[model samples]
Target chain A: MTQPPVIEVNGLMRSYGGGRTLLGREKPVIHAINDVSFQIAEGETLGLVGESGSGKSTTGRAVLHLERPDAGSVRFRGTELSTLGQQGLKPYRKHMQMIFQDPYSALNPRMKVGRFVGEPLVVHGVDSGSSLQDRVAELFKLVGLDPSFMSRYPHEFSGGQRQRINIARAIALQPGFIVADEPITALDVSIQAQIVNLFQDLQDQLGLAYLFIAHDLSMVRYLCQWVAVMLRGRIVEMAPTEQIFADPRHPYTRSLLAAIPVPDPDRVRPDRPPFDVAANVPPREAPLIEVAPDHFVLDHQVQ
Target chain B: MALLEIKNLTVEFDTPGGVVHAVNDLNYSVEAGETLGVVGESGSGKSVHILALLGLLPCPPGRIVSGEAWFDGRNLMALSDRDLRSIRGGEIGMVFQDPMSSLNPVLTVGRQLKEVLTRHTNLTGRALKARMVELLDIVGIPHPEARLSQYPHEFSGGMRQRVMIAIGMACNPRLLIADEATTALDVTVQAQILDLVRQLKHDFGTTVIWITHDMGVVAELADTIQVMYGGRIMERGPVRPVFHDPRSAYTWGLLNSLPDEGARTQRRLYQIPGSPPDMSNPPPGDPFAPRNPFATERCHREVPPLRDVGNMPGHKVAAWYDLPALLAAQSEKEQTP
Candidate 1:
């Protein structure tokens, strides 16, 4: 029996700068995400892999309703979040959260870490007073940080420690689903492994569903069970991690995977085509076709 | 004869807490026209050592406690300010991580490129303009003539970095130091830059000092790899031997920490349990001992001398364990399936 998805996103579209210029001329429209669709099963991770300007972050934010998409449908646990007002969305917001790429900027530096983490609880009115303190301390321990560090400022902690605090804040209200956007990209490799492991451990313990957005292919492969390849504001391919890695059908997905700098010195990287968007643009827009059981690829037919 | 040799290089910073030993009694030599890749986490002194060699570090808080950097039959440490200034951009060029900030935002790209040429060469007027355009062309910039008139803000990240490379190659320096040059760029762009540098190294016959934390980048670019940690070189050898048969446990940890290039599995990544050591109060023995899984009694109490591996020329490792034993243990771990 297939379990229902905790988060469902369909036909998501977002564009930037199209209305008018200072001279009242029509401005150029940059499609950040176009007709994107995906689902995150309960306690599952859906990896979104793409290069910069590929609309991965926009998709994550759009699903959270943080950046209201121009057109889309976002359903959280059978409830349509797109049509809900702020007051109505408040109840569902407690279950969904977001963890940013840069922990330094994501958190408020002036406030104490405890206050920052417990802010979610205060906003949601989940707990207060001594019980709030206990939850904050428990969160610290869960993310492998000392409880006493809650009183310290964000500057006192290292990058990894700050990220742990960020994770503590993200999971403070017992969020069932999180959009971790490039959570480990800014970290060193050694520290990166620690964060990835922590994410896995948290997923297993809390039964959390994650929309893991990142540019690192190997990292995505290591952490995610299902992967989606995004390019030019659309998902070109989506499949189980093993199958996608074993045999990627889309040309864009193949290029992206091959572009990754493998640690092996013997690996011969293909000659990279220059960053010309016009050159790689699909000659004909292809519909998402099922190549195998639950596997889809955008078969862009080039003229 | 070695192109550059450094001996007993020790750098320290006097802070409110204490003196932070950044580089301690390091000895290494680089051959002419070879790319020396330095891999280390932050505070490892890889960047600091080069900065010190280049006389780029500020002196009130920072001081080169002791060391001799021998290059071109002269001690770079003893060079006067004026003398060093002549050598810096003329004899050695540097490419920093953030190219946008490195290149002046207000200045036109042409003027910036010409300034580097004027400082080191006698070319002026039309000759200088021609050389600037040629340098831009060599670095793979499109419409070199038009790009010259544009400011740094007009160019993209990759384009700005190319402009920086053009400036670095303007003087045709013998040694090029690139510190985290490609770290900020995306993988595809990084591959392009790596390829450009690799090709430039051959074409220009310039020795390179490539410093970064990514082992994959080092493997792709550098002919030799130097694994550094806690102000010391943990391992140094040709890329193949150092990767295939790493004697240092730290190197092993770094290699294992890298996600396997193949398919994803249920296996947990190898994590080095602790952070890097504090420079102010560094350990008495192996700096990596606290995090090393195979650390022994000697690793904690006594420092291991840099010794040549048995019958492996040019491969030196600083560790307490014997080569055969370490390889046996590594192979055994690999056999676990």
Candidate 2:
């Protein structure tokens, strides 16, 4: 990326109230995301990978200010976002957008696809007349959808096509940075490749920096230049793509790498070693410790 | 002898739009204790084929266009609903993609297992309780005696999938149709589930129709792979040939697109250029012709039948061109991204 970092996150910390009542209700504080930090260079792709409850999705949402952080600061370009309240954040939202994982659930079923995609444009007072329709049509083409099909509902399209529409909506604003939360995870096997390629295309054409959150480790290695492996609300490892795959030192990272199915039938990978089942895992109770030049690991506690 | 044989099975669905030819004269088989992985993207009719065999398709919408699914020398397509019901869940269990929706939320996990057991066997009282605990243990659920009382939501994503396996194996079904069962799981959880399925096959001689989109996962689990496209089996053969050097252009595109564990030299991630052929108005030729980079005029004009590639026993491919060359080209194209 020729430009400077588009987004910088520092010492991010957030936890839900378990014992205390948020709305007079009891819930496991989830410890959703804690003390996470990362940066997205201009047009760079930073992937966050983990199993369920890893808090990757939470971290992405928090940076967009969709959720309040207990502690931390988020900076976009040269401006800081942590100081922005609802009123102050409204103007800056035009520069940022989010693409959710589930297209069907994320979209408003009751509304027309055009209205849903164009709603952001309208809210920002960007455009609303014939120009809005033109922009929407252009977006449809950009995302590999037929512009004539804009007069449709979310339910009308299949999983893959619906995802294309979701992509169109996310890129509608020409935002500087985007948070795509598992955008292609719900798609079909064949559809995943198309969606992934579309992301690459959009990134090149629009120069959009993205915080890509997903569970698919292989695609992450392909798509992102840098990656952060999250677990139980903290990043356990971070490094350049090649560095991480060549030698994953963290136990959690190794387990994640092992999870990816080897495509070659002739290949033999000794994935399941005799782990002393009771061996001590790194205690992630504290902050992440640097293990290598770029790689980092958290001492995560295991059962 | 093969445990299950699908002889030229074809299927059609009556949706509001029109009749969609879901499975076109598909023929395949599975032997006892063998796992046949069916690979395809969405709309490839992987689920529909399994649904037809299970007699679980929606009425008026789903009609077997022709052909039959034979198991143990009996034609399942000709069986009465009552007999089919006896086979389903009792003799052949199913596991779907999303574990969250597959299990009943209102009912405890034990109750669900008991339903299948009561349906298949005559076990009751102590025997039923004992069998339930044993099944739970086999699926690797911790503290089975205590978890029997817990509901689906109480378990994590991975644990819930284990419960699904326990339920699938409840009646000790001869065949298990795992339809995208682990697609929703994390890599670690996915590995655990795959290992469990493998163990199930080893212990029970359970033949499996493992439907998934992940090529990597299929390569790991399947003894043989059946690659489907546009509601048809474009390629069916041993996993090695189909995967090592794919014949079909669609299969090539899929393989090239995967994010592998190898060093990150994947440039553009070879993406299939066009969307899957519109099934609503599907054309006459190869369904993947439009999206295939190496597609020629002949590809758009004639639907290539699944042809035996050489006389190499069970190996087969369905392309009009050299598959290995096409795959190599696609692989090189992927490196450019």
Candidate 3:
């Protein structure tokens, strides 16, 4: 608990489609992510959950500096990432990597799986010749993929295997942090468990922190240590995984949790009135009020 | 007689790689007004069988080798293209997975609704316009009259799905087949669509064949559950029975593999060891035998017939080994440790 956090985000803001047009006509601004803040300690996972257009993915992208935030600071190991230009941020890119949702499209069809996995290492100029191949093979083995099949194209591998290839590529440089945006969402149910297990295994072995962004709350509850609930580009609730599931305070959080369809047939799901987002819009400057130890909820009452 | 009965249905696809046995001897029946949920991973032939029945599967590659799909005393498989077209949107409606691709981008929502109504019914002009608006209203779309003129791209993802559902319900079809209908939507939006479908069933007594990979969704919406794997029915029974006590190892493994509320306590989820079966060259005996931990010697050599479970009525499974007994023993071993 006392260890320095791996990544810390503060008052992060990012918007799209704003500003005056050529004719001086005003363009409506859409805040993809607004005033988002969170921290991920060493080897700890922070589950970011929300419905579509809630900016969960944008927050992840902003944290990794893949999409630069319009405002606020992203400190990766106490180094501010927002201020650093592309050339300056090159060194830090290896320490923080991202795994996207679609396994099919994330991988290049033309490239061999071995070269794809080893691409990061090659870019970073870490290893060469037989060593790079050996590293890629080791990475593949770590993700529970057969090292011999590295020569095959992306089409030859299954969905689960393709994801493992992506993971192998992401972790080829042994990054301290990973932003896995809906990593398991695209795979089959049986394969999802395998990938989750792999994520856990990798984290344990390498002591990697993760910003696991997904809509599947059950998986989030199982894998993540902390959970953050986002609604309309703002985090309405932030708490420990157990607290977020068991004692959600925000109406949006409660509605989000209640919406998850339980696997059991006998259990009667309570009829919860849907949270009307249009009616109750969380203000832009709403402060995150601490309700419990390490648990925070946005103060919706403060107009 | 059941409302719709499928017997010995086998579907194949001819490809350069090999002949893909998409659906292997699939046999099942759906009673009138009952919700039958078809659960399976991709390439399990859950969608293909329905497509074949509707005569939607493309020729040259997809071939329905053998089967008889009897719907309302008529063999749907043997029906002519003209007859099938009349039955498709008239007597039997279908809601596909992707609303965006399924809907026409250029046409207004009202036009799309009118197209279905006009093809199936004798409604004209004002009556057709009124029916379109009513259908949209039934699907819980706000400002139906104003919304009708809007295009597919103009609507949100959830609203677009609602429009698709409205189109499916336009003909007042006795049977509705929704293939992974809510899989693409957000959870809250999915919940709303599920409620809308349930409401439709309640009001009109519509029989539904809900196809999806999510067991949770099946548990919530379906009265009966049919678990499919490797293009074969692994298990079928009432929702409670199949979920609580599955006879097939594949079904058991699938239910256990999900990271449900119970799974939260455990350090790791119970993974069903290997990948899904390759349909092109499936194993000789049981397709799921490779991943099934409790597969017997007989399972590796001969395909098990889908037979009724001894104790449970209406419950059927295709497996050689006694799954319940094996699971009991496995649990007992873990308990002792």
Candidate 4:
């Protein structure tokens, strides 16, 4: 709490399909992310969880500057990111990286896995020649993949292995922060554990901060120190991992928790009614209110 | 009598690499009004066996090497294409994982529903339209009549899945097979879909074969659980017994791999050591033996027969070594430390 946070985002807003048409007809604007604000400290993971179209991925993209936000500020180590142009933001890009959901499409089909992993190092001008090869090999070992398989194409590896390749590339620059959007979603249940363990290991070893955006709440509880619940382009609740799981204050957060299918057969699934989004529309202007120590819930009432 | 029965079912693919053993010597039966959950990762043959039974698999590359699937006193394997077509959507309805791909993009939701009804039932004109509306309502789609004219792309992912379910339930089929039906949808939407399925089961007493890799989903919905690995059933039993006392190493590993919801401390997940078996050239012995920690020499040498557990009724496991004893000793060692 003493040192400044690694990444601090404030009032981040991004919308699509707005503005007047050529015919002067008004077009409806869809706010993908609105007034999203959070901070991730050094080596801490902030889990952004919600259903599809809730803008968790949009928030992550905006934070990483992959998608330029319309308004607000992204401060990486107290440096303003939203105002920076493409060329100006290049230096900050190395400190932040993103891993996408689908590993198959994220990788190049023709490119060797080694070259793909080392591409970041080459782009950043961190290393070259024999040293680059040695670094890529070290990265492969870090992610629990055999360095020998670096020569093989992506098609030769499985879903879990492909994800490790993506992770290796993401951490190749030794970035201070990473935005892993559903990294374990595509892999099998068994493979999911391995990848999760790798993420934890990498975080511990390198002291990397992560913006883990995913729908799997259980995995979020296991990995993240902080959790943010998103709904309709706004974070409805933000709290510590234990607090979010143990005592969710927001109605939307409680509903999300109730919806999770428990792996235990003996536990009877609660027959709670689905959260009515139409009935309880999250107020656009309402700010987050502190409910408990480090726990914030959106100031909105259920209809 | 069982609603559906399969014996010595084996499926293979004639790939360029080699003959891939997709499903091997599978034998099981689904009782009436019971939900059978088939759990497995990709390429485990959980979906393939169903495709093979329904005669949906493409010939040449994919072939049913040997199998007999009995349904309603007739062997599904012996049925002609015409006969199988009549029974597929009529007696046994199917809902696949991807709703977008399964549904026709060009046709309106109404048209697709009509197509299924026309093929299976004799309801015509107003009656058919009424039936379609009723189907949509049953699946919890709001304002079914207004929504029917909308195209597939017009509906949300969750709504489109409901439409898929409505189509599957159109003919009032005796058995419903949902293969990872809610896998693509978000958890909130998936919960709604699961609720809809649960409602349908309560109303019609429909026998369901729900195939998914999510043990959590299966635990919530299914009466019986069948764990598949490398195209073979590693374990099968009532959901409660199987989950609480998994006899197969693969099943045990899968259960342990999930993050324990009640764990006070965040501990490392118990990962199933190796990747899934390569079907192109699967090991002659137990398919999961290589990855299994407690695997013995016998397990690596020869395949174990699916045998009934000593005390648990209807519970069966395919394994060479005694898993319960091994787990007991392993736990005791950890506890002492």
Question: On residues B99-193, what C-alpha lDDT tens digit does candidate 2 reach at each position?
Answer: 88888899999999899899999999999999999999998887999999999999988889888888888898898989989887877777877
Tens digit per residue, CA lDDT, model 4, A1-303: 444699999999999997899999999999999999999999999999987898999999999889999999999999999889999999999999999999999999999999999998998899999999999999999999999999999999999999999999999999999999999999988899999988999999999999999988889989998999999999999998998888888888888898999988899888665687757767789999898898889988421
Off by over 4 Å in 3: A19-26, A301-303, B335-337
Candidate structures ordered by TM-score, highest first: 4, 3, 1, 2
Give candidate 1 regions above 4 Å deviation.
A19-27, A270-275, A282-286, A291-293, B323-337
lDDT of 1 by residue, B160-237 (tens): 988888888789988888999988776767777788898888898999989999898888888899999999999999
User: Which sequence of candidate numbers ranks them by DockQ, best first?
Assistant: 4, 3, 2, 1
Comparing to the true complex, what docking class would candidate 1 get? Answer: medium
Best by DockQ: 4
Query: Which digits, one per residue and each the tens of the lDDT, describe model 3 over residues B173-266?
Result: 9999999888888898888888899999999999999999999999999999999988899899999999998899878878887786832687
* Top lDDT prediction, candidate number: 4
What's the interface RMS deviation of candidate 4?
A: 1.1
Which digits, one per residue and each the tens of the lDDT, describe model 3 over residues A25-71? 99999999999999899999999998888999999988988898999
Error of 1 at A257 (Å): 1.8
Task: Return the clash pairs for model 2, or none.
Answer: A282-A299, A282-A300, A283-A299, A284-A299, A284-A300, B267-B337, B268-B337
Q: What is each candidate's DockQ, to 2 decimals? A: 0.64, 0.65, 0.71, 0.77
Report, for all candidates in order, the number of backbone clashes: 0, 7, 0, 0
- Higher-scoring candidate on lDDT, 1 or 2: 1
> What's the chain B TM-score of candidate 2?
0.93
In CAPRI terms, where does candidate 4 land?
medium
User: Per-candidate TM-score, first chain only?
Assistant: 0.94, 0.91, 0.97, 0.96
